[model samples]
Target chain A: MELTGAQILIKLLKEEGVKTIFGYPGGVVIDIYDELMKSDIRHILVRHEQGAVHAADGYARASGGVGVCLVTSGPGATNTVTGIASAYMDSIPLVVFTGQVPVHLIGNDAFQEVDIVGITRPCTKHNFLVKRTEDLAKTVKEAFHIARSGRPGPVLVDIPKNVSVTKIKYKAPGPVKMRSYNPTCNPNKRQLQKVLELIKAAERPVIFAGGGVILSKAPEELTKLAKRTQIPVTTTLMGLGAFPGTDPLWLGMIGMHGTYRANMSTAHCDLFLSVGVRFDDRVTGKTDTFASQAKIVHIDIDPTSIRKNIPVTVPVVGDCKCTLEELNRMLEGVDLGDLDKKRKPWLDQIQAWKDTKPLAYEQKDIIKPQYVVEKLYELTEGKAIITTEVGQNQMWAAQYYHFDKPNHFITSGGLGVMGFGLPAAIGAQLACPDHIVVDVAGDGSIQMNIQEMATAVQCNLPVKVVILNNGYLGMVRQWQQLFYDKRYACTCMEHAPDFVKLAEAYGASGFRATKPEEVESVLKKGLSTPGPVIMDFVVEKEECVYPMVPAGAPITEMLLV
Target chain B: MLDADKHVLSILVENQPGVLSRISGLFSGRGFNIESLCVAVTTDPTVSRVTLVTKADQMIIEQIKKQLNKLINVIKVHELTGSPFVEREMVLIKVHAKPEHRAEILRTVDIFRCKVVDVGAEHYTIEVTGTEEKLDAILSLLKPIGIKEIARTGVIALFREPK
Candidate 1:
């Protein structure tokens, strides 16, 4: 059948089961917008291109599908770079489409034309510039396939304006057959047998999970392994919900700002069965000292990630879920020999460390940031999908909120991009309409993407923005105070717009609370509101996230409060 | 010097516009140095062979190979350093040849199995194709004759048949 490139794109999206797209239309993408109007796919018109990409990322994280976004060329494409980098760092599955100038006009400095394919080559899993109308369908198919396949990441396809309007004899492309792109999904049985042997013999073993577990959707298998072997589970920031946070074996997050018990356990463990983690520097602290006493068994789909940071004794190259399943099957027959009784001494030691330096803070007259997150978690019954911006607000949310399911807590863990939460909440809300979506943002982070509030209100997303208003960039301020000897520098933001008024101006409900007692009531009101709402809680200005390991220091050498 | 750190990689990639850039970009982005690189269309017109030379330790070499394999355009990466391979590099040397030195230069070229492709009134442009060590030996022998200029192609290689 004859169809325009734009129509073919829409049909292929439908074929791929894409029900929603976050995008912003511009001169080059007007044809795509016109074609989109004739389809049932929901198009969220974001205020900015960055918001569109972040929203798509959030939608993908919430729905466990490839997120799609569309934007114009030049500045629109450039604006999405930060968002694309963030998704790439976290391994979120996303397909970003940017409208380019015509094929003839390319490389001639045409209006709204930029080498987006070249610019994003480093960040995207793969990228393409569609020069012909006939290649659009196949390119789109390949983009989605690469984005959602093993070790998923964002992919970009730059479509010229002329291609969108050009007619083509359309046919659904065949399944992706790139011989060079096949990832190792099923692990070798012998390597997994070795891992099983290590697990059975180790006296103190810890399961270190990361974003790969969440990306591979192997939380169930991971939890099973941890439970069956009686190994304590410690997750990286991006792996927050991979294991139940409230479980007795949960060691909280492990790394720079990790729980004292988790870091201590990692330092002392004999075997580290790290599943799906890349061993990022933030998670490793001082690489030489990280898991020094442990025999690490690193299992990940990406072979390069296995020994790129810290060397491992056993490296299994395969998908996280498949490897875990194989390991679990192998464990079915082996006699673990009374795991709980064997692990009692290690568990008791961990418990002693936890009891000695539990995550705590003083609740003064001023509202502490941790108190707000705790209250929000309580009022929402721990069922809300929480997204956070960078710095103190993010750390506090990762600490206080206990996630009982995978993908419930979404944050920019690897890239730590500011202004990610608000729009991400919008995307999450749209993905799961009935779930409570909240952006646990700081005073500085909320202002970065404040324009997204308009997008939320227009869509009636009912996304609650809970701003921890400390009147400063709290994380940087804390660092300056601790290390720089009270040289605040530019971290202090004493003069800022009133968030409640700002929310009201965006045609959304607004509330505020100054005292500690009013925090709970304000959270309740804001979360219970019908449309989009913003709750501003004035928090203590100088409160710091404790147990911070100084840069380049060992994770065990933490400065506790 | 025959150093273990130096490696020759034979990579097969799709004959696309930016495949070379992507491979080179990967090297530069990761702080890996490309000592020499050459590309040409292979027996399959749609595929190109990129022979890249780099100096790195075993771990870094493993990382480079894995990273090269990760690119979608790259079909395969083979390390030819340890394998039985026939490698060749072409070099053209322009040496200053006075009338008195002409016989000596020609005799030296004859000994090295090189050809004096171009002859000027005062200089001779000699062309030679051989292994890196052979080319180096010829260039060093000709350098004492006051070589004017030189041009060299990147090293390229193919595996030899098993006996």
Candidate 2:
């Protein structure tokens, strides 16, 4: 059938089963917006281009589908860079469409023209420029396929203005050919056997689960392996919800800011089965000394990530779910003789370490960040899905909140992007409407994408945003105080808008928690509200994330409070 | 050390305007030296293809591959020393003959599978198609008599099977 480029785009999206899209229309992309008006897909008009992309990212993360966003070129395309990068780092699937200049004026630097393909190359899985009207259908189909395929990532399609206006006979192609892309989901049998052998032979075996476990939805298998082998599990910051934190075998997070017991146990374990984790610097403090006492077995989907950071004794490259299934099968017949006998001494040492320094917070007139996090944990009974913004709030959430299930604790660990929580909470709430989706956001990070409050209000998404107001970029201030001799340049914001007023302006219920006693009541009120609500908790300004291993120091050499 | 099947290549490079000098300088800088060298561009255009015959073993060929990857805008390069490939050369011979022996020479041309593209009263331009050795044989056959002019198309090759 003869179709315009815009109509072809709508048709392609319809074929892909896309029900909704988030974007803001401008000069170049009006053709798409006009075509969208004639289609059945729901288009959400966001306040800003950044908010649009973030909302799309949120939708993708929550729905487990490719998030679609359409925007004009130049600033609209440039504004989506942060959101695209966030998804790229986290390996979320997203398909972004950008309107380009006319074909004739492409090289002449026409109005609203930018080389988006070149700018986004490193941050995307793959990208294409639709020069011909006939290529639109194929490009759009391929974009979604590439974005949602194995090891998912964002893909951009830049459509020229004239191409969108041109008429062409469009028939959706079956599939395009890509020679270099291959994603393996099943573990090699020999490698799986080696991992099983390592797990069976080791006396003190610890399963270090990361975000991949949650991403692959392998929590049940992980829990089964942990219970069957009687091996304790320690999670990275991103891997928090992969196993129940309340389980006796759960050792909590292990990293620079991890629990004392968890960190020490990880350092001392004989066999470290690192599953679905990249061993980021935050997790492995000093590379030379990290897991020095352990023999490493790494399982990951990406082969390049196997020995990229830390050397692995046994490298099993495959999907976490498939690998764990194979492991469960291998362990079904093997008798783990007297598992308690092997773990008794190690458990005693770990308990002793936990007893030595439990996660503690001092109660003072000024509300400490940890105290607020602990109070939230107490009030929610550890049932709420907690999403965190970057910096101090994220670290506090990681330190205090106990996640009970997979998908319970979502944070931007690899990207460390601020302004992630509010939109992510919106997406999470949309995904699990019955559950309480709480975004633990810092004041600085909250303002980055606070406009998402509009999205929440429009959708009536019941997301409770708890803003930890410290009056400074708390994490940066801590860095400056510790390393930069307290210069404190640009770290402190003298005149900040009242968050309660900001929340009110966005048409959401607002509350303030000033004293320690008010923390619970304020959070309860915010959580009890029918729709989106914001609670501005006045937190201590100078408090920092303790147990910080001075950037390059060993994890053992932590500076605890 | 050259392989038993290795062949020597002779290439003509244009000496005009430091082009030949630049080409030689490039070869030496990249640790590749020419075994045989010749110069001059033909009448058609203001360009030249430098021909350098080298004794490149397999390892040396690999090194040359690496160096060629670094060159900016070098049109084309290939190793013409393998089987299952076709190689052809063209030679134009202007032979002096009397009118009486013209018929006999034309008959010889037909017997040798050559074409006379240009014919003057005294000289005939006979074009022969064959291997370099066969072309040399034809040139040797005409050496006893006067030969006016000669021109040749360089050895170009194509793989027998599709690449």
Candidate 3:
């Protein structure tokens, strides 16, 4: 049957089980928007194109499905770039749709015409520009597949306005063959045997987990293997919820801003079983000096990631869940005799370090960031789905908050992108409606995508946004203070919008807290509110993210205040 | 580091505007200077194949592969190094020739297995197909008398067996 490109798009999304989309309509995408009006899929009208993309990102991360977004060309498409890059860096599955100029006037520089595919190429996993009406269905299907497949990332489909209006026979192709896109979900037997042997032979073995464990939902398997092997486990910032933070074997995050004990244990361990972790530069301060004493065994789903950052003694490329299962099975009868005795020295040293240089916040007249995070954790009882914006606030949330369940904490760890929390909070709330969704955002990051409050009000999604109003881009300002001698170029925002007024303008409840005593009350009020609420807490501007290991420094050389 | 042996690369990219810019940007950003870059549309209108030549060692080639794999529009990248590959280059040489030298030019073209595609009053455009070095030799032979203009189809190499 003949169908318009717009109809084909809607049908394709419906076939992919997409129930909702975040978008804004404009002249360029009027045909698609009109067709969408007749469809069953729900579309949330975002106040800005940036909000649409971030909301879609949040939806993808929370639901573990392809998040969809639609926008017009030019500024609409350009505005989504930051969000797209954020998702791309974190490997979130997102299918982004942007209206394009009519085919006839594509090269004429017509109104609202921009080269979106060109601009988004570096930031997306893949992109397509629909030239023919017949390719619409196939392109849309391929976009979803590529976005959700191996090492998931955002994909963009730029459909010309005229093509959307053109009618053509829509026949969705059965899966297209991509030879280069082979993703292995099973571990190689030889590699698994080698890793198992190394684990058994080593005296002190530690399991280093990352977000991949949570992405693959292998937390149960990871915990079981850790318990059976009696090995200590350390996680990266992204791997927060993969293992219980309160467990005895758990060493809370290890990195520049990680706990001193976690960093010390990771550095002193003999056998490092890195599972589902990328060993990002932030995690491995100096590549040459990172885990200098450990023999690394890296396991991940993507083959290319193996040994790409750090040299792996045994590289097993497969799904984390499957690999852990195989490893657990292989270690069933092996003898790990008195390995705990060998690890006692390392553990004792780490404990001593922790006792002396624990994660501490200075007692002051004003409320500390850690105190605010800890209070939020206590008030919510560690049951809330917490999302965080980038920089100091994100580190504080990760460092201070204790996560008890998997997929409970979402943050942009790899890309360190700001403006992720608010929209992601929206997506998380939509996914788990009964759960309390709290977005811990900073003043700088929240303002990046603050316009999403309109989406919150429109959908009546009660996402409690707690803005740590530090009056500056806390992370950049800290870097400037430490490295650039406090040049403070554009990091300081002396004149900024009143966040409380901004929230009220979006038809939502707003509150501000200047004192430590007011934080819990404001947060409770915001969370208990029927609709969306924003709480702006006046935080100290000059506060820095401590326990920072300068770039290329040894993890043991972390600077603590 | 430049290697003595040259490596041929075939990259499939989307047929979109500024895609070339993205490709070049990647090559330049990573300091992998392309020796030769040629782009042409494939049978599929939406796809284009770019053939590039670079004098890179094995390590640099691996780095290039990783960097190219990261590009969004780049569908596939293959390196035809030490492989049974069919390498070809097309060179159109316009040689200045009078009526007296026309027969000699024609004879020379016949001996080199080249074709005379266009013949003007004072110039003859001889199309030569061979390796880049072979084409260079042919151009050198034609340059002594008088050469007007030259156009070349940069090296496009394909492996004899599937990778």
Isolated chain A TM-score, each model: 0.99, 0.96, 0.95
What digit string (tens of lDDT, one per residue) describes model 3 on residues A178-274?
Answer: 5445567899999999898887777767789988888788899999998888787889888898889888777778998988888888888889999
Name the docking class for model 3. acceptable
Docking quality of model 1: it rates as medium
lDDT minimum window of 10 residues, candidate 2 chain A: A175-184
Which ranges of candidate 1 are over 4 A from the true structure?
B1-4
TM-score of each: 0.98, 0.77, 0.88
Tens digit of lDDT per residue, candidate 3, span B1-163? 5363577889988787677887887777567778888899999998899998987766567667766765656788888777788989998898999988888888889879999999788989899999988898888877776889998888888789776
In candidate 2, which residue ranges exceed 4 Å CA deviation?
Answer: A175-177, B1-163
DockQ (0 to 1) for model 3: 0.26
Candidate 2 global Cα RMSD: 12.3
lDDT of 2: 0.80
- Per-candidate DockQ values are 0.77, 0.03, 0.26
